[model samples]
Target: MSERIPVFKPYIGVDTAKAAVDALDLGWLGMGSYVRDFEARLGSVLGVEGERVVAVNTGTSALHLAMLSLGIGPGDEVITPSFNNIGDFQAIRQAGAEPVFCDIDEETLGIDVEKAEALISPRTKALIGMDYAGIPCRLDALQEMAARHQLKVIHDAAHALGSRLHGRSMAAYGDITIFSFDPVKIITSIDGGALVVETATQVEALHRYRLLGMDQSARRMYTNERAWTYDVADRGFRYHLANLHASIGLSQLELLSAFIETRRDACRRYAALLAGVEGLRLPATDFTDVAPFIYYVRIAGGRRDDVIRSLSEAGIDTGIHWIPGHNFTLLKTCRRGDLSVTERVGREILTMPLHSFMPAST
Candidate 1:
């Protein structure tokens, strides 16, 4: 059989395994010192204050808490792109807010700020922008638009951990910025994510919110202690990241620079190899400030299905980045504007194999 090229394979090494073993030896596997350590390291990487980064169990939890922290709730509306993962939509709905889907820019494939601005209303509380395929949405323009309308901006930086815009890190924008460390992401903490709050007060609230509303629970966790008697100030959830997962995240952080270079190189290689292939539309290869998470191409001439089948037969795996949220039964009833670009992209987008661990021979 020919060597299989899967959609993605995480870069795992001896250092990652050793870090997990170290956490195992520590015996306190809950949200302990290691989680704090990971958060501090991540803060350094993003150039944010260490205490401002709140580590969570998943990126969805981060988004959910972010909306709630910003006081978005029932009867409020948040604008987002339909060319995004369903998690953002679910997070808005979970916070009792409506998600107003917008279209994407044909070139960058990121949210269309002009379309989002048109959809805003008195009830629009915030705007959520995703870094699609590691290319950041025009955050400055979006933030300016939000400011003019007195709305908050939340950045779903799930695909943009190591990406940069105008020499600043992706986390430097938005009222709140979030990251994902799922297995297929640029880095993995086994399964973990984080939210970056701008103010100390908000950070404190996020710390408590992630630990089931127990006030100052993060301080206790850092010292390997728990509060036997605690008071719930407001609503919260058990969403804090565990030490075991954070340990793995720390290991991944150590290799982030190399991982980014490898992925960027692979993406460039794919662009070079697949350029001018019939019916394939490739993204621009200007990755000077971006760390791409996926290598995607647009299949024109209604040949996406045939291309996928051919690749499968050759032991190569592929995928679609997303299906528009409006297509989902659960979210079909939500408010939305014109999704022409979103629908078009959904039909043509195809994700090919790209990862840091691929064989150099390829």
Candidate 2:
């Protein structure tokens, strides 16, 4: 490597800070017009005609809205991968549903479609497929399974803002797709996320659910602004992003194409650099339109910790993307059956720094 790398780097600029500054000076720091504009702009990126996308404060809220809108409440089981971030689990629980754990396949580092099948029960309501490190999930296969099981599909696209599969965005396939705009993503909205949903019913439900569940429309209020006469139709939260976050998001979204290209180039270079390294595995590319969001390499022979320690000592901080969600103390009691592969893969995986900020080197 030409230069030292950190665990993660946020792709950002002065323009983003200026946008937030302008919002601060204005005084209206609540969610309003900016969020709507961001939503409209983001919806356009879906590459799907008439795609209805909604922007929320965080990715968690987006998933929560997806579950809530689908009426997935207590006793409903949402089959999900235990190989990635646990944010989706909280969203499921918040929607009063249980998140059923499914193991990942070592070959693709994605949820084993067959393993997912075994976990399905009569109470299964939905399936949330996580696009681990920008690799688009096998949506076609998963969708087929979802349809057969009568379950809606939600995509945790937190690391897949600009990722694609077969020229289609992940959001284009899932019933509800959530994109996180956190600092370390390909693009940064400072701190924000968007939920690409379908149908007016789902959009309206998301809007209300994120904005206090209040009928704040002027038509429903005696005054020009929202009045005290409001109803909490569903369990809602103040998950609406401020104008500042939206402003920054707008700038970042415009720069997404370039960022994505850079990330792809980096992944190709990384894969080539370590092409013949033994005891290491490069990411699989079953999907043609693969768009990488992280620089991860799986260390075989259980030397993942050694690599991380070595990288850290060399000023190249590395990270393990996640631990199995079921391993968490909170969910330990709920874990059923054996999860050996999921347990081992959880430790063997390591992520190197990847973003658009680093200078291109030959």
TM-scores of all candidate predictions against the true structure: 0.98, 0.92
Give Cα-based local distance difference scores for all models: 0.90, 0.76
Query: Model 2, which residues run further than 4 Å from truth?
Result: 1-4, 48-51, 218-229, 286-288
Total backbone clashes of candidate 1, pairs 3 or more residues apart or in separate chains = 0
Model 2: which residue pairs collide? none
Span of ten consecutive residues with least summed lDDT in model 1: 353-362
Report the lDDT tens digits of candidate 2 across residue range 241-290: 87788878888888888777777777777887888999988788632365
- The candidate that wins on TM-score is 1
Error of 1 at 84 (Å): 0.5
Q: Model 1 reaches what TM-score against the true structure?
A: 0.98
The number of clashing residue pairs in model 2 is 0
